[model samples]
Target: MNLDHLRVQIDSLDSEIVRLLNERINVVLEIGEEKKKAGAEVYVPSRERAVFDKIRSLNSGPLPDEAAHAIYREIMSAALALETEMKIAYLGPEATFTHQAARNKFGVSVDYIATSTIGEVFDCVQNRSADYGVVPVENSTEGAVTHTFDQFATTPLKICAEAYLPISLTLLSDQPSNEVNLIFSKQEVFGQCRSWLTANMPNVKLSPVESTTKAVKLALETPGAAAIASVMASDMYDVDVLAENIQDMQGNTTRFLIIGQEYSAPTGCDKTSIVFGVKHKVGALYDALSVFKTDNINMTKIESRPSRNKAWEYYFFVDIDGHVEQPEVKRALDELQEHCTLMTILGSYPKAEI
Candidate 1:
């Protein structure tokens, strides 16, 4: 074909694509109306997951799944905004890891509110000031965020979805690494980079801050100072990154949860989290866990925390590899309940992609 003919063909394809997109939007509007009539949530996490999964299955593309999903995320975000205004709450003054994870799940087009503390994030959702909340649950290097686990013990909120953010910490500074005398970041970030900091800046001071973004701001204003933070933060703060991937582990990841009023239905592959307290007796916890073994269910994680209301008492949290509504899971919980002082199904959500 001639150059002009090929350009004409491309224009024609673009026109059709635009028309199809409009048609899709109209249909989505209709569905949104129907959902309103039935009083259903406009942002259904299970439905959203199914759409992304279908996109992956249907794509035979030059674009990768991650890239395609990112595009679709914005499209969905726009539709969701039109359907109903969504306000997502996250831990921050802005530019925190939780803020980035909130964007990862909700997309850049949606509204966001940065809360001073994780408790305030939950309070925003609980008070109906925000439609949903996002908070960090666990880090690959540092284990669970105890505050999050503890919050679940009292909060009525449930996890609807999860986002796994691969964390790459960068060394940002106003001065060169050799001459830098002060370092700042969240305690967790410093712990993750302990070895590197010990070996490279042995005599430099390490200070824990409220957030990594705060550390960046401190580094910017203070002389002979540096901050270990996300590369995105470096760009946002206009600080030079002295080094990339400075974390001690190559694949450090943080799991963030999307918490709301209700849990999502099963999406075939699911995970359920629950917290319970075993009765104070010998073999009590052991017999309690055996319920899963008898039911042939896979338990992914188990954690314990002191029940602050009762001295020396503890609560146990567990994550298992199926929805709570599944027959085996249901049966296991039924059996397990007999040995526990209390049991609560935290939430059942789609398993995050590897």
Candidate 2:
């Protein structure tokens, strides 16, 4: 065909596409209205899955399957955005790792509130100040964040989602100097970079700081001193990264949780978090765990914390496959509750793929 004819054909196709998209959007608005009438959430994962399935099954076009799904995913996401906005709370003075996780999950368009502490983040969601809370649950190198687990022990909020982000540590310095006298960093940060620090700056004294932000500030004031922090810290402090990804383990990662008041139904791939305490008797703990075995529920993580209210007593925090609303999960929970002195289903959330 001539270039003029090809241009005309392209314009015609564009118009057809635009019309179809408008029709789809109008239908989405009607669906949103129906959901509002029934008091259902705008984010219906099952409905989304069905839409994707139907599209994939019916697709026989020039556009590839992956391309079609990508377009549809964004389309559905836009439809949900039109229905409602999500508010995410995170531990921050801003630009912290928790902020990164929050933004990763909800995107920059979603409202974000940075609370002073992890506990405060939990309160923000519990009080409905925010729709969801994002906080670090565990670090690959340092293990669980006790403060997070403790907050979970007291709060009614549950883990509605989980995510992992590979964390890279860096050394930020104002000017190049070999006279490194002090290294400022969080204790965990220092630990993660121990090998690198030992090899290169063994003479430098380590000073444990409150947070990565604090370390950056302190290092700025102390000449010949460096702050061990994320590369983001250098950007925030107006300093240069002297070294990057200094953690001893190259693959070091942090696991974060999304806490909210609502419980998610099973997404086929789901993770349920729970906290429970055993009765003060032999075999009580065994009985509590056996519920999972009997019900064929797969346990992913189990960590213990000292009960703050009761000396010599411990609470077990567990993460497992399946939502609490699922029959198999419910049965296991019932059995666990019967055998335990105290119990709570923290939250059932879509399992983290990253």
Candidate 3:
């Protein structure tokens, strides 16, 4: 076809695309009204998962799966905004990793609140000031975020969904690499990039700060200072990227949790988290864990934190392979509860795609 003919066809296709998008949104609005009358949640994780899965399966084109997912994410995000004034609270000063994860999951169409601490993120959701909250739960290289786990020990919020964001630390600065004499970042971030810092900037002083986003702000103000943070922060703060992918481990990822008033329904492939305290006796912990083995349930992770209420007492947080509503999982937890001083089901959420 001639160039002018192709151009005309492209314009025609664009017009049709916009028309269909509006039609789809009109139906979404009708569904939203029905949901409101029935008191159903505005955001349903199971429905979101099914939509994404269907998008991937139906995609047969030059466009990549990630690209397709990103497009639909914004579409759903817009629908959610129209349905309600969705607000997401995340740990931040802005451009923080948690903030990025929240945006990645919810898209750019919703409102975002940046809080200084993980606890505040939880409080926002608990008080109904925000529709949902996002907080980092663990890093592949650094292990569990104790603060998040501790919050789960007391909060009434449930883990409705989860997201995995790859951690890519960079050296951001306005000064030349050689002129930089000090670096700033979160303590955990410093540890993640320890080897690179030792080899490249051994003489530079490392300053641990409240967050990477805050560190970027400090770097921008302080002469000869650099910050180890995400590339997104560099762009947001207009700082130069002195180094890229500086984290010690390749493919390092942080797992984040979405907290809400209720957990998601089963999606077959799911994970359930719970916290419990066992009796103070030898083999007590073993006996409690043995219930999973008896029921042939797979335990993915376990971590213990000191129960601040009592001296030397601890609570064990566990992640199991199946949903809490599964028959075997229910039976196992019932038996496991018999061996515990206290037990709480944190939530059952769909396993995040790594």
Candidate 4:
């Protein structure tokens, strides 16, 4: 065929594709409405996974399977958004790392609220002010976010999903001045950029702030001050990016948790989080953990927290291989709970796919 003829045919095919997608989306919207009535969750990672898996299996792609999955994820996201108005709460004054993580998970279509504190984020979810809350849980360089751990122990909300976002720090300041007298960032953030500070700006005073956004705001207001924060913060606060990706380590990352009222079903690949307290006896903790080993399950993470009401008592937080409802997981939990004075299943959530 001639070039003009081919171009016309391609354009016609593109138009047809759009029309078909729109029709499919309309049907998906009706399914979402039915789900709402049946109390089914909108964002089902497992169902989405199944869709991508089927596509990959059938795919003989010049476009590639990953590309196909990417297109489907957005389509699903848009369809879910059409079902209900989702409100997401994140730690913020806006432009915070938590805010970015929330946006990454929910997309820009949902309503996002930036609360001043992590507790506020949790409260938003618990009180039904928000559908979900996103908060930083751990970092690759620094350890756990203590407040997040504390919330898990106290809050009724469950961990619905999790994400690990690479934490990139940027040094931002106003104007073109290089005379940086002070560095502002959160304490843990400072630790991640420790080597960079030691090697480049050792003499500058480091100021620990409540958050990255606050640090960036201070830098914008104060002369000779530079804020070490995510690249998004610099853009939000209108500060010049003095340095990009200034984290000491190349693979610096932070794990964020999604707190919500709903529980997630097993995504085939799932992580179940539980908390239990055992009587302090010889090999008590060892015996409790052995349930997983007996069931041939993997323990992803374990954390110890002091019981608030009782002195000398401790609560153990665990992330295991399978969903809570799975046969093996159910047996393990039942056995483990018998070994403990108190036990709680915090959540059985779909493991972070992205």
Question: lDDT: which candidate is best?
Answer: 3
- Looking at candidate 2, what is the lDDT of residue 295? 95
Q: How well does candidate 1 score on lDDT at residue 297?
A: 95
lDDT of 1: 0.91
Model 3 per-residue lDDT tens digits across residues 6-96: 9999999999999999999999999999999999889999889989999999999899999999999999999999989999999997899
- Candidate 2, residue 45: how far the Cα is off, in Å: 6.8
Q: Rate residue 317 of model 2 by lDDT.
A: 98
Ranking by lDDT: 3, 1, 4, 2
For residues 1-354, write the lDDT of model 2, one tens digit per residue. Answer: 999999999999999998998888889889889988998766554455567678989999988986887677667656656667767789885656777766665655557898888889988888888878889989999898999999989987767677788888888888684866898988988888788888988889999976777788888999888888777777876898887888999989999987777766677778888999998998989888998999999999999999998899999999988887789998999988998889998888777645
Tens digit of per-residue lDDT, candidate 4, span 189-218: 899988888888888999999999999888
Which residue segments of model 2 deviate by more than 4 Å?
A: 1-35, 42-82, 177-179
Clashing pairs in 1: none
TM-score of structure candidate 2: 0.82
Best by TM-score: 3
Q: Candidate 2: count the clashes.
A: 0
lDDT of 4 at 351: 77
Least accurate 10 contiguous residues by lDDT in model 1: 93-102
